[model samples]
Target: DSDSKQKKKKKSKASRSDEDYVQSLNSREDRNKSWWDDFRESVEQAEPEGTGKFLFLKLLLNETCEIGDKVLVFSQSLGVLDLIEEMLKIASERGEGLKSSKGFYRPWRKGRDYYRLDGSISGNKRQNDIDAFNDTKKARLFLISTRAGSLGINLFSANRIVLMDASWNPSFDTQAIFRSYRLGQEKEVYVYRLLAHGTMEQKIYGRQITKQALASRVVDSEETGRLF
Candidate 1:
């Protein structure tokens, strides 16, 4: 519905102008993620609120990982996924190899499956990413934006998912969970909902759930959880 944002500009030509614009956007995203990753430790410390989420996910995933074990991290924006990848990277870097300490297992995620939140991916690219995700030798994490990657995707390879941010639409949450909770999921699907306490996220998520049933019954439903 209205929750979907407009598609990014697309170019059908090999012009330098189009290439430059896309490159700039990519550069901006890279710079932003780099800055955030650098500040993530301080941010975590300043915001102890993440403890509830971190602990919850740790418990859900059992802090252990295996090949072909996929995880889809759901957030409101694409930028959040980038930050999460950095968090995962940090986790993997701090002596997180297989034969390490007590809680040192992060999944073997690839560089390509760090997809944007939407369906901006081309058909070929999507399949390649999916293939890698389902590959037993390569990937285990599939970080995605809730708004973009929630529907029409089979994420049955994962037994767990982490919702980085709650949405007003419970169906949005439902669709996101289906990425793992769908058919062929061998294990008990565990979905962790992360809500930022004492923020607009809490109120919006609560109100959104209340409206979920009602909204689905009508045609002209109000989409309160639209893009920021």
Candidate 2:
């Protein structure tokens, strides 16, 4: 009994040590400025990195606008969606042929060239937003929540889709992509999945691929057996 108690205490100490080490590693700053100062500066500047998803979004939006193609941007987090909204607002103010209304983000007034859909949008309002994007050629971009737009929404007007973040569940991403390939979709659709290399996002994407491959094999086997 004394031996078992000693082993338990040792295990607890080991766990605590691991936690402390992780915390220390995380706390070590890579930049000269403190974390809070860096965060504040980043918010104020809002300067997107060259290879980052935000920069890619800007390029894609500009190209799509030139070609008169629509785009749907999906993110799982509301905070990210808000940031994107702000980016669009800034872009619009810079004579980018986009606009933002004075108040709430909902029903964003951007010269009829942009629309937004999220969980906050009601059924009717969501449909209205979708219709506005689909029915009009002026609408060039639609920002949506990954969860809210992944299911039962037909966004065939947008020939391009952008996954701003990766989800652990592969089905969510698949659903979001397929939303643009609905029944009335006549044009070829392009889907862009943005993931930071050497980060957790890449790891999550790898997991998603593994799950999809396994599921595909299972479905293929069942079909083959039925054919035999």
Reference-based TM-score, model 1: 0.63
Tens-digit per-residue lDDT, 126-220, candidate 1: 66776666654334467776666777778677776888888767787888888888677788777777887899888887777667746665876
TM-score for candidate 2, residues paired by index: 0.73
Where does candidate 2 stray beyond 4 Å?
Answer: 1-36, 39-44, 48-51, 99-111, 221-228
Q: List the pairs of residues colliding in candidate 1.
A: 168-208
Error of 1 at 195 (Å): 0.9
Error of 2 at 134 (Å): 0.7
* Highest TM-score model number: 2
Off-target runs (Cα >4 Å) in candidate 1 are: 1-62, 66-69, 97-120, 215-228
**Local distance difference test values of all predictions, in order:** 0.60, 0.72
RMSD of each: 8.6, 11.6
